[model samples]
Target: MKKLLSFCLGILFTSTLVAGEVGSDCTFKGKKLSGKVQFVTSFPDFKVQIVDSFPDLKVQKVNSFPSDCGKWQEVTSFPDFKVQIVTSFPDIKVKYVDSFPGVP
Candidate 1:
């Protein structure tokens, strides 16, 4: 009985850890990380931090064709998603690259 309980607890812990991981698919917390993005000071859909290495997503800023994952187009009026640049406590960490933008 004790061994069974330990096994169940271990499974639960592993699942919990996996649930918080962000994949290369560019989706986090059910929010898709593509399309036109707006930078805002407040009331953002996601808060992100720019990093030099070990990023959750590799981002490429584009003028058009933000349809693919990790591609973002900056817009003011109509945005598919809004993000706030934060120094700390970001929802995800990203690295801006010139090419090959996607989950890494």
Candidate 2:
């Protein structure tokens, strides 16, 4: 019984370490989106916002990982579009992606 308990605790600890975490990973309001969209940025894990105005925004995560990652860029076509990720207190960066369709 002692051996069983020890093994269970060991596994729990291992899983916790292996699981990658997101610090403030959730986007503006905890939503994901798809659209006639393409990519201007990429990350292994990210939170995406779709529109300029708040309230009806969306978030997106990636599956095209381990192949082509570590790329982030600006929204070329939608030059007026904007996105912000929390940096420090009262600070954020606006990085938007030009999403057209099936590219991201």
lDDT values of the candidates? Answer: 0.85, 0.32
List, residue by residue over 7-35, the lDDT tens digit for candidate 1: 99999876644313456567987878899
Candidate 1 wrong stretches, greater than 4 Å: 1-20
Report how far residue 61 has shifted in candidate 1, in Å. Answer: 0.3
Best candidate according to TM-score: 1
Residue 64 error, candidate 1, Å: 0.6
Q: Which 10 successive residues of model 1 have the least lDDT summed?
A: 15-24
TM-score of 1: 0.77
